[model samples]
Every structure is written in structure tokens, then in C-alpha cells.
Target: MMTTPIPKTMHAWRKHRGNMEAVWEEIPVPSAPPTGFLVKLIASGVCRSDHNLLTNEKQPSWFQQQFTLGHEGCGTIIEVGDCVPSNCGFKIGDVIALLSVPGCGQDDCPECSRDLPQLCQTGYHSGIGQDGFYAPYATIDVRGAVKVPQGVTPSQAAVATDAVTTAYHAIHRRGEIKENETVFLFGLGGLGFNALQLIRAIGARVIVSDIKQENMDEAKKLGVPEQDLVPVGRSVRKFVEEKGLVGKIDTVADFAGTQETFEDAQYIVRQAGKMLCVGTLNHKNTVHMKIGIRKRLSIIFSYGGQTQDLAKALELIQQGVLNPQVEDGKLYDFPAVLKALEAGNIKGRIALLQG
Candidate 1:
């Protein structure tokens, strides 16, 4: 019953096969779907994953028409379809953050039944599988959205969709980190920093490894002891020993995903320890299979989190278990943002707040 004047076309940042992708340009607005609704973009996180997608030229084969590239977005509902189920809890004018993928709540579907539809390779995902936000208007699967509460900024809500959820899934869920256990975080970027917070909240210890002194300094400010921070040039094995963490590191949540970090993490994890690969790296890793097999290490490559995981991330934010930081200025200038990302000009997580 509620309505907002839907535009015929609006300025957006899109991804095509060629050079036209990153500029702020005009594109037709999408229509509401029978099982979904339309969202008016408010804020979206300019993630490193987007940079990875660009550099890797990772548009999937199923894509015919080009889709806009942002998946971590928050917006207000504009159009509602009658066929959308009441159980989905969507209504016009509600502020929400999108699920990165579609989890059709089909009872018989294996993934949907287990609340892990992100694993359903056949399913549709935002940005990767369909046109995502990064536009003035975009469609959202009704079951694939979570309400953003008033206390959270739209920018914070947007990053919570991916950065926060992914960190939570990799840290608390997959890592299975118990209190007092030590976690060595490789690369203190967006996802890495969030995992630091969650691990800290769990009363666990976190040792950080970063190439930048600024990143190491940031870790100190976040309560990681200066002694626990390891500069990247140093060997991962040597640092693990110097910190007295040799054979003691329970989990290594690898956000850097470089060959060096990947191989290093595998070497240092304790027996039965889990190493969660959360970052998207362009390089290939060469693991020492003999050492890996001997340690009985559990190496898991994880992608995005489930929709329920996003809901849990929101709850943690509401409870002050996490604090998301977004860089000031450079909000909504997509072309410039992409340039900064490519040049590595921006440090930490940055958000683009747009209409």
C-alpha cells in the first residue's frame, strides 16, 4: 500500500565486460518481482571483494546482461509485491540490508532446508548472480533481507551484510574458537579487523600480522598488545615462536590470502586447529602437504555468510559486541572510489552513502 515515485532511469555504477563498468552512468530501474521487492539505495560498502572482482574479471558465465556490482548494501523498501509471502517480513518503507545471495525458502531444497543456501551453487546471488545495489534502485529477494535497526547507520548496516557476517562465520562458527584460545589474524583489513573484535569479545587472544606499520598501529589501538603484533617481513613461524604461541595458535583466520600467508598459516596452526581462508587473493597457494597432513589441520576456504548469519551480525552490532569503522569523505563517488581502491589509496573499510 505504500509507494515512492519510482524512477524510469537513474545514475548508477555498473559492471560490463569492458571499460564502461565503473563510471557513474544512467541505467533503467528494476521492477518489483512476485516474490521480491524493490529497494532504493541508501548506503553500500565499497569492499575489497569488489576490487578483487574487477581485477580478476570474474563475471560468471550465466550472466548475459551486465549487473551492477555492489552486494553489501542497505536501503529502504520502495515497491512491495502481493505475491511476496507474509513470513518474509518485508513491507514498503522498511530499512533493510540485503542478503548477498538468494535463499529461496523451498522446503525440499537441501541448502534452504539447512539455512545455508549460500552453498547452493545453483542459486542466485546478488552482484555475482544478478544485478545488485550500487544503483539508485534494485530488486531484493523478499527472504533475502534483514531489517536494519535505527541505532545503526546505513553505512554500518551495509558493511554488516558481508564484512561483519563473513568474519563472524569464519571466526565463531567455523574456527570454533573457545575462550582463552589464541587466534592469529593475517592481514588486518575489513574482514580481519571484525574477526579481531569478535574474537576479543569472546575473551580470546588475537595476534596480528600486517605489512603496514599503520595496520599494526591500528591493531594496538584496538587493544591487541604491541608484543602480539607481528610485522609481515618476519617469518610467520618465527613470530609464532617469539610470541610463545608455537603449537599454541588455535585458529588462523587468513584474510590476506596471499601465497605467503596461506602457506604460513598452514604451517603454524596447532593440531586440530582450523584455518579459515576468508580473503580473495589473486595468487595460488603452495601448502606443505607433509606438514599439513602431519598436523591434522583443518583448512577451509569460506566465502560469504548465510542470511541468518547476517541477522546474527546485526544483533551483535546492536549489542555493542562489534564496532564497524567507515572512513570519512569519498562517499558515493563510485568512479573515484574504484580508482582509490585500485591505487590502494584508501585504508580500512570505506562506505559510499548515496541516495
Candidate 2:
């Protein structure tokens, strides 16, 4: 099969003025930034956050209008910029996943100096605070790209950068979910599903909860047992109590920060139990210090893909240890993808395919 030549203009999903669904447009193919590379995106994962953006809810004021809305993108380099090394371990056709962090703009901020660009005081973010990869090509800092391992597919690697890596960091680093411990996951969305796998991978017994029956069934199908999967509408604290696990759970990871979940997190965890909030839920989650103080509870908010965490997740994907259970994922070209995402019926992931 002959590969098509790069086009001068490419299809992109852009959110125009005001808050609205992303529309397909023949937009200029972005050029490589001064110190970055232009990647020909092979696949990009549609996240739940993308659903929110499409509805014009939870968009940061700084994002403005007319931007792409996917952070989980995997592709290969097609154009290189000036400052990046020509042989910086990335070749013209090497498949890679772009880490979600936006490149720092040569800022003299303290966080940037400390090698923490994600926390740069200037508040930059990819696919949200800036243009992202929902098209054929995306510009990224060469340093922000991690090459996908040989055994990982572009579709799997696309979600790996955020969903998988977020789970790995939350379970292993933040919550310290140890081997032989019990973990309670309070959500069955993409992030929660991956968290279940990661917790299982770490040799922990996991109990997953979701209000949607389909989500509950999917979690069980993804290796969580029927006995362990709890439907969301019921009282979680009562479930923990009836199961005789009031003080037995070592870690509770809440992807859904609902009022009930937070209350349940404190109630279900044992003394000194850790609670990991992997995704933003309900906008502002405020905890009463008095309630947590008595239990010695620890709370942490996990975000982004830490480099080392991403590497380990890639290793798991390569080894078939952790893989997303992508059911009903639609594979589309850029233009069709924009329409599907706007319609808002996609489940699992909507993977955009590039030549």
C-alpha cells in the first residue's frame, strides 16, 4: 500500500467561539514549535473530560476558544524543530505517546527550574489550556514524548499516557496500596477501570463500585469478580459494614468525589487508611479536618503521567499485565471522529486513526 503524502491542510476538531461541540474544519496543519516536533498522530483517546468539554462545562476560563480537546495522543514524529536534538532517541517513524504536560515557554519559574514543568506557576496544560492532538498532526516538546514500546498498539498507548499512568501513580505511589491489602475503587469509568487492574496487578483484592449496571458488569468482565463489584446507587458504607470490612480496607480510591463517596471513603477505610482521589469530581471537594483527624486518614489528589509511572505502565501493557477493556470503541478518521464526539454516545474510548 502506498502511503499518502502529508497534506498542507489537515482535518481538525476545533471548538469555535463560545461553548459548543467540536466541529470538523480544514485547518492549517500545525508547524513544529521552535524547540519541539510536529507529530503525525496515529491515534488519540477520547476521555470523559472530553465529554465535559463538548458540553461546555468545566472548561477553564484560560482555555479560550477554538482548541483541540484530546490529551491522550500517540503518534510518530514527522517534523522536527530547531532546538531539539536530531537524534534525541526519537526517529522519523518511531511511534510515541505525548505526555499530557504542555511544554514550558522558556520560563524562569521555580517549578520549571526544578524540572517540574507540570506545576509551572504560569499554569500551562495541553489539550485544555492549549491546543491538543485531535487531528492528524500535533506539536509537542520532544522531551514530553515517550516512545511506545514494540508490543503496545497505538490505541492502547493512547489511553496509557493518562488513564493507565494515573492509575499506576494513584495506587502505587500516592495510596501506597501494598501487596495483600484490600482496595476499594469508587468509580467504574475509564480511570476507575484501570485503577482496578493496577490494584489487582499489585496483588490487592479490589472492590469496585459504579451506579451504572453496564459499568458494574464491565468492571466484573474486566477481571473484577461479581462478588466484588458493587453497584453505585446503594450505600457504600453499608456495603462495607455488611461485608465486615469497616476497618479492613487499606486504601480507598475515589474517582467519583460525590458526597456519598467521600463519606464512604472515611467510613470504609481502616485506621491510617489512605484515600486517593484520581479524578476531579463535583468541582470542589472539601473535607472536614476534624473527621479525618481522628482516623489518621490521608488524602491525595493524583493527576498526569509521571515519567517513571508511564514507563512502568508501558511495561505492563507490553507484558499484557494491564490492558484497557475497550468495548464499543469507534475507530474514525479525524472528521468523523469530531462528529461522533459531539453526539456524545461513545462508550469506552473513541480512537482517531491516522495514516
Candidate 3:
């Protein structure tokens, strides 16, 4: 296999144990694991969750005290490990997108055996409180790497690993949204905007509600009729009532998990309607049991997407069926980019490129 000179150390943006902000420091480059590859990162996408990682005091059990912070990554393989299967098709020069959390694909593993690898507790979670692709170099297991398609750029491929794939998984797998369904979509941020396109692609009618006028306008430009957009600053409940849409919505997909949006979802969706929860703008949201019981709503929460979802999302992007709105920046711009993301100043998503 072709090889490039491996560097001894590279700069990475990491979340320190007590620091409220991310710290950039030089760290030793990692070697490929027995069943993984050492990757030279080309692009890494900044997510709103990155802000949570920086400031949130509580973390999952597997979260490291200090780790690099970037979950969405795309790169070229620089070193292949000995245990990487010969027939798996990955090579030193191949470009691939990394799955942040690829569950152990073991028969004895509960989550993976049930085909929910994204929820696997035993697996390594790249970037989510784990050493990840914020640096020039990182390592990824074979199961977490998906080859980049011909038409997708490195920026697109990077965001596709999470932003697009998560939306795709929620809409298709969890929501099971159909062409005949009328969906009430909440929020038009990174994942929500991508979810809008995915819903549109499925021939579903989507009525979108977002606090940002720019986000709503972007939705309109994506073929959402003006009538389908909730007026900016208007109460979502009031908008639903005004449109005479109460109990008419087949599914309420809440990609902005704010308290208000969660309540609005319960009020608007039809009886027995499905509620697909994908975002967590507010970590804890209340579900009114009386309303839920009376309406018989099905509340479904979705997390990260599987490798197949990423592959399918890439295919859609390649086919021009899904255009992930993203801006490019240098890897060092992570702090500023994340701040802008938290302030809701960024439109869609931002991908940081390696300098």
C-alpha cells in the first residue's frame, strides 16, 4: 500500500476537565488500531452539540475527562492496520467519512445485535468526549468508516456523517414518514433543515416552524410554500389554530427540543400521531401525560444514525437529492465557529477544513 510520512504530533482542540472553553494543544499522532485506520483528517463539521460538550457539566459514563471535540469528520486513510480485512476495500489513499459512534458489531452485544449500533454503550464514541478528528490525524475502526462518494466534497462528506445522516435516520427509520403524510417540522437548524429536505424528497407535505426568519426563509427557498411556514415570532400553537391544522398533522418531528416546541407538538399532532424527537436544544423536556394519554401519541426519540444511513445519505447527496448547506473554515476556527453556532448566527452547518 502507498504510505505518507507520519507526523509525531499535531494540534487538536480539546475539552479540558474544568475549563469552560476548548483548548488547542499539540498532541502525539495516534497509530492505527489493529482493526482500524490512521486517518489524516481533511474536514470536520462543527455542531451545536459541540457547545454542549464544552459547557455541560454532566456527561455520559463513557465520556473522557479530556478529549478532542469533533464528531463529524471526513478524511483520507494514511495507514491501514494489519487486521483490516483484505476484502473490506479500504486502502491507505481512500477517502472516508467517520461514524462517531459505531457500536460493537458483536453477537453478544445487545445494541449492535439488535441493529442499533449508534446506541451501543460499549463502543468508542469519537468526538463525543473521546479522542476524535479535531486534530490533523485520528483513528477510526473499520465499522465506522464509510467511503466518500464521487460527487461529494470533503466538507459535504464530513457533515453528512452526522447532520444529514441523523436526519435521514429519524425521518425514514424512526418517523417512518410517508408520501401521504403531512408533517409538522419544528426548527430548521442544521439537522432540521436537512430533515426538511428528506421529508420533501419523500413527497411529504411539511409545515415548518422556526424562531429564526432566515431559517424559515431557507425552508421556503427549498420549495416549502409560504402558507406552510409559521410566521416568525408567532406562537406555534396560535399558528396551528389559525391554520385550522390542530389534529390534522400526521406526525410532529421536533428537531428543536425546546419546552415550547415539545408542548406544541403534543397539541398539534393528530390523535395517535407519531412524534419523532431528534434535537435537544433543551436537555430536559416535559411530556404532559394527560395530553399524551388522551391523544394516544407515539413519542419516539432518535439518536445517531447507523453506517447504512450515512451511506444512503451520501448517495442522496451524490444524486443531488440532498444538498447539505455548509460553509468551510480552517480547523483552528473551531472556538469561534462553535460560538456562532450557539448564538444561532450560523446558517445550516459549518465544516472546518484542514490547513
Predicted structure with the largest lDDT when compared to the true one: 3
Write candidate 2's Cα lDDT for 1-355 as tens digits.
3556777898777766565657777878888876778898888887766656666555556765677767888888887788787668876777888876743635577766765555554544667757787878888786577889998988888888888888887778778888889989998777787788888888889998887888887777778887787755777887888888888998889988887788778878888888888766677766868768998988887766566677788889999888875432433354455456556455666666654
Question: Which of candidates 1 and 3 is the stronger one according to lDDT?
Answer: 3
Kindly indicate the candidate among 2 and 3 with the higher TM-score: 3
**In terms of TM-score, which candidate is strongest?**
3
TM-score per candidate? 0.90, 0.86, 0.94
lDDT of 1 at 2: 41
Order of quality (TM-score):
3, 1, 2
Q: Write the per-residue lDDT of candidate 3 for residues 1-355, one digit (tens) a residue.
A: 5456888999999999889999999889999999999999999999888888889969889888889999999999988888999899898799999999988889999899999999889888999978988999999999999999998999999999998999999999999999999999998878898999999999999999999888887888899999999998898888888999887899999999999899889888999999999878898988999989999999999988999999999999999999999999889989999888878787778899997
Whole-model Cα lDDT of every candidate shown, in order = 0.79, 0.76, 0.92
RMSD for all candidates, in order, please.
2.5, 3.2, 1.9
Off by over 4 Å in 2: 1-5, 54-65, 102-108, 113-116, 121-124, 231-234, 284-288, 327-345
Clashing pairs in 3: none
Query: In model 3, where is the ten-residue run with the lowest total lDDT?
Result: 1-10
TM-score of 1: 0.90
